[model samples]
Target: MTSIEPITLTGKFVTLEPLSQEHHHGLVDAARDGDLWKLWYTSVPTPEGMAAEIDRRLGLQSQGTMVPFATRSNTTGKLIGMTTYMNIDAETPRLEIGSTWNAASAHGTGTNPDSKLLLLRHAFETLGCPAVEFRTHWMNQQSREAIARLGAKQDGVLRNHSRSKDGALRDTVVFSILEHEWPAVRNGLEFRLAKYSA
Candidate 1:
């Protein structure tokens, strides 16, 4: 199944590898860079919870419901974050790219965009998926803007979509890019990446 495959996706700035225990320490350091776990709307794991989080993701992978990745920086050769193709529906051929977080240092450094380029390319070109979804907490304006920057259109908000780990109700903002729209999105990503190279 397209959504269940474990594969590496490489880009100019980042490489997406199958998440493993070996990435545990690097991920802890990356998460600590910005104390990302402090963000109320996000589910970023604290250093102490990193291993359990990895286990959860791997468990989901074993169930054929998610494909997780450890994102490593090409320049630093360091794990900077994690991402995944989750909420997978193989029959519909759709997957949601979620649970993504990066080190503070990797922000605005071409890491995010290039990583998206690779994921989007794989989802559309390799997997032949008709659409891919992205969801974030409504309170996370940074993530919403970043998703829009990748040429995804807002699909609407799901009020009280789910309960967060802290027992708070989460309003999820969903966005998506369709297969037919991939060409334009690809062009936009390439154009954005060009600026970093320049």
Candidate 2:
């Protein structure tokens, strides 16, 4: 069963489009906006390594383990970042919305919440998923706050869950919104996005 398919998810501020090699240059420029790769906790690719990273993500998508998206800003008409539906468990029909990074310029622009709202709506309303998970490095306080703002509860921390891009052992902070909780979460996200328009 192909639980996750590449699909375009449009929102007021951003659209999550299926990933492609053609997005490489745009992604690289996004990375350079804040030297995102230099951050120790994130897995963002360097400008020179963008193509290889895109290929790797596509390879995983082919293997049915991930569905990656290119985050595009509707206002700018440019690729601004990337996000993915990863750690897919087809049997449970659940997945994690992760591996996400955005250009520094895109921060505080409602792009993140808009993306989450779109992803969560499709996951729960259309895909019939019971739970949608989010995982971030424990050190990434900004990310943790963002996930929390989306109404996800902390599921707990996984000690030494994985390695960061800098090879540092990472404590993964897991969060989730259950099927029962999605309604409130969706409302909260929508309220947040609505502010961008006002």
lDDT of 1 by residue, 77-125 (tens): 9999999999888877889999999999899999999988999899889
Taking all chains together, each candidate's TM-score versus the true structure is: 0.97, 0.97
Give a tens-digit lDDT track for model 2, residues 112-172: 9999999999999988899999999899999999999899999999999888766779999
Cα RMSD, each candidate: 1.2, 1.1
Runs with alpha carbons beyond 4 Å of true place in candidate 1: 1-3
Q: Cα deviation of 140 in candidate 1 (Å)? A: 0.5
Global Cα lDDT for candidate 1 = 0.93
In candidate 2, list every pair of residues with a backbone clash.
none
Candidate 1 lowest-lDDT run of ten: 1-10
